[model samples]
Target: MRYCIERLDGQHCLFVDGRKELLIYLKQASSETITDIRKVYRNGVSDSVLEIYLPYRKQ
Candidate 1:
């Protein structure tokens, strides 16, 4: 599988190859929190990646 995410500024897009680890991250991160943000790109891009803000990362 192929994954793509856009930057917060609506400038660049992030491409991720669907390896096992990333797939798991994506699935688990789906239920995380997201603050109000502007939608820039609707295609293979993201306004923000929520995994960074996950509480589990502090460990």
Candidate 2:
């Protein structure tokens, strides 16, 4: 399975294996500002995908 990660600023998309391990890894690496972490599924199946909206960047 393939997992897609969309950055908060909509500037990048990362693809990874769709698995709990991968998600956990990301969570661990993320900072506290990483909010709105969500998992996306297709037809109720784990798509191994997550969408994270980080705190908005300061100009």
Candidate 3:
């Protein structure tokens, strides 16, 4: 599975492919600002496992 980070309406968002529990856990555990988590489905398949809204982080 892969993940992508994007910006929508000025809010940072995350999208990750489904079926990977460890990946989800790792992301959540490593990030403190992640919130509004939800799943997305397409054609009844869980194509996107996580849609997390977070504040922008400065690197």
RMSD of each: 8.1, 7.2, 7.5
Residue-level lDDT tens digits of model 3 in 27-57: 4554444433445555443333233323322
Best by lDDT: 2
> What is the TM-score of each predicted model, taking all chains together?
0.32, 0.40, 0.38
lDDT, ranked from best to worst: 2, 3, 1
Q: After superposition, how far is residue 38 of candidate 1 from its true place, in Å?
A: 16
Q: What is residue 34's positional error in candidate 2, in angstroms?
A: 5.6
Model 3 lDDT, full chain set: 0.44
lDDT of 1 by residue, 2-59 (tens): 4454444446544555445444544554322322222235464535444443443222
lDDT by residue (1-59, candidate 2, tens digit) is 55555555546555556566445656555543332333556664543212332322221
Stretches of candidate 1 off by over 4 Å are: 19-59
Largest TM-score belongs to which candidate?
2
Name model 2 segments beyond 4 Å from true. Answer: 31-59
Pull out the clashing pairs in model 1.
6-45, 6-46
